[model samples]
Target chain A: MLSAEEWDILRLSLQVSMVAVLAVAPLAFACAWGLARGRHPLWVLLDGLVHLPLVLPPVVMGWLLLLAFGAQGPVGGWLAEHGISLMFRWTGAALASAVMALPLMVRAMRLSIEAVDPKLEAAARTLGAGPWQTFASISLPLAMPGVLAGMVLGFARSLGEFGATITFVSNIPGETQTLPLAIYAALQVPGQEQVVTRLALLSVALSLLALVASEVLNRRMGRSHVRD
Target chain B: MFEIDVTLRRGERTIALQCASAGGVVALCGRSGAGKTSVLDMVAGLVTPDEGRIVAAGHVLFDSAGGINLAPEQRRCGYVFQDKRLFPHKSVEANLLYGWRLIAPEQRWITPQEVYDLLGLAPLLHRRPVNLSGGEAQRVAIGRALLAGARFLLLDEPLSALDAPRRAEIMGLIERIRDSLGLPMLYVSHQRDEVERLAALVVEMD
Candidate 1:
């Protein structure tokens, strides 16, 4: 028998994760494109910074986020003044997840973009496409497989984001307790073992599902690029 | 109308090109890396030369002396790459319509239906580039450039990537594009046959 609280946590987790993924998509695409195409010294530094969160301890990342966006720090201070809050909220969890997923997204997109022929881009230009038009039309779509893979991987990463989310947003039940946080909360209590197990199972299942979907999508995209 | 006289000093390799034109295909014949495409790059505002004056259709496209270089999209010339660089995300229809969107709507002299007819692209209109064949892709590419309101056309080894039969097919498509569009053209090819088949004027590179 599932408790109402457990179900509420589960539902909230899904909502927050999906919103997080949706919000991060555009940012990820831009970062990936810059890393793949933009040629400036600063681009390299920024690329490294985006990938930094992937290497840093999630707890440390959360601490940094807490400082910068905690309704008191610069970003957070500005957000609070603007009547938007992220600290210890579900949105904060999403941001944390987004930061964690950024590197993977950038990596996948870069690979796909690199695989494309530079000559093709030159061709697009000669066809009278402005730079932005060329990017929107040629670069983005051809990098679709990578984009899809990036999204799936990001979603999966966000689904299990534990330390950074917990540290940055805190595990406020119903408001910010994502699946991993909820599971962590459940595990701390003696009688909530069953709930923890269920959520854990759900996480594994979702990750597997995402991987399968990416494989299928990539294969299909490959085929379309090949034959009748 | 296009005219170019340029000397590109690349580290040590000097790419030299000389040609001038008003309204006909100017064939640039040379071995690979003989600076044929490099010349087109300068005329289309893709590359800046060390010393050059380039004029296209009475416009100052590029001139090292004047320090003037127009951007590619602003030049209004059509360029067909060897690989047929169609937008992968768009349908054949959308890719063809891309350049069409850039020009003033009223200034457009080419129609999608006409392009479809010219390239035999009707059956493939809804399809993405990933589904196109070698010959079909090149034809669509040619049609796309023509419909994009190009006053000048550049074909850079337009048939180099295909098999002999596919190459022959694409060559004919190139001819059709040139004949129908009536735009001034600069065609780059090493194959003398290709030069003879499509060019009305020849500029041989050493």
Candidate 2:
């Protein structure tokens, strides 16, 4: 019962969010680890910078991304030489969404890491584990629930992100137009109330699905960690 | 043998300690925060002092004058936290094996079977940390360190979290490990009874 454009928006939403989560997962883990455990003077400064996107206007964020990653921008120009174009493309949408979702991901991971006792790490080190091995074998597995919760929360947030993605990548149908943009376009067309209604229902369903998935995954992970 | 000489100035209280252990349990005895944990932390390379020298079995883990400050892992000091600090997600067996994976086969001393026998972990091998009792968890913590190829074990209030009966059970196990392996240990606790029962030598702190 859905039109091709509607399907295109749904597919694009999935693609954009998946790419965003995958690309930033390792980086997010590193950032969260540094924030939770680092004891240097600049730790607070780094923490503040990581959370900047959460407080800034999404539109403003999109604009900054455009200025920095657009073809004319210095980094973008350098990247273009390597054939990596993130402007007005799917990658651009992912970048904007990842930037928007970073704060939420970091928050979830930080709490989990802080909850882990330092003594345990000392125990591992005594057993001859290097820092990286300790993290990989001990900390990461223990923090799986929080990491799952963060990734799901970020996916849900990206499904609703309007300002940043729109500003950074613009609303190009079948290219960057996600669920929110599609709904916006439907509302602008007069006598097209039916399309608007359909899109709204779809958005609610998608968001609800993400939320439900998160709860399920977190619960399952929590069960495994607690027993052992 | 392990030898440490250091002075720690915490606020106004300046605590200086000098001690050496040679393959026997040495207890750091005092009430809470009697510099008991600080001493062990320094020896384990967890904390740095203004000026100090820690030589454990000929390896200088920390020497302020020599510009040598080895990390906890490099120092080969096995630490057992108060709460056990088991990897919550892994099974008891996996948690035990976590440190083993990082160790070369030649360096690994404690076998899984030895751990299983030491703490009766065979029954709870597949269980998670949440499923473990207080006594069982501490026993796992002990086994985990042993399996990781620890040259020296640093136990910080290892049995304080348990009830009376559970503490007794774990203490018997500790005695057995001490008698069998003769491994050097720095036992930290405020309980005078625990210190007297387990340690061969006692260092009283203010």
Q: What would the per-residue lDDT of candidate 2 be over residues A7-84, giving only the tens digit for each residue?
A: 888899989998998888778878998999899979899899899999999999999998889899987999999999
Candidate 2 DockQ vs. native: 0.60
Candidate 2: the clashing residue pairs are: A226-B130, A227-B128, A227-B129, A228-B128, A228-B129
Interface RMSD of each: 3.2, 2.7
Q: State candidate 1's TM-score.
A: 0.88
The C-alpha lDDT values of all candidates are 0.80, 0.83
lDDT tens per residue, model 2, B1-206: 77888988888898778888775788888878678888887887777877888887668888889999998877767778776778776678888887777778897877889879878999989988878988888988888888877787889898886899998898888888888877788888887787796788888887
Using lDDT as the measure, the top candidate is 2
What lDDT is reached at residue B37 by model 2? 81
TM-score of every candidate's chain A: 0.92, 0.92
Report the number of clashing residue pairs per model.
Answer: 0, 5
Candidate 2 has a TM-score of: 0.89
Candidate 1 interface RMSD to the true structure: 3.2
Can you give the TM-score per candidate against the true fold? 0.88, 0.89
Tell me the tens digit of each residue's lDDT in model 1 across A11-53. 8877877887788888888888888879988998988898998
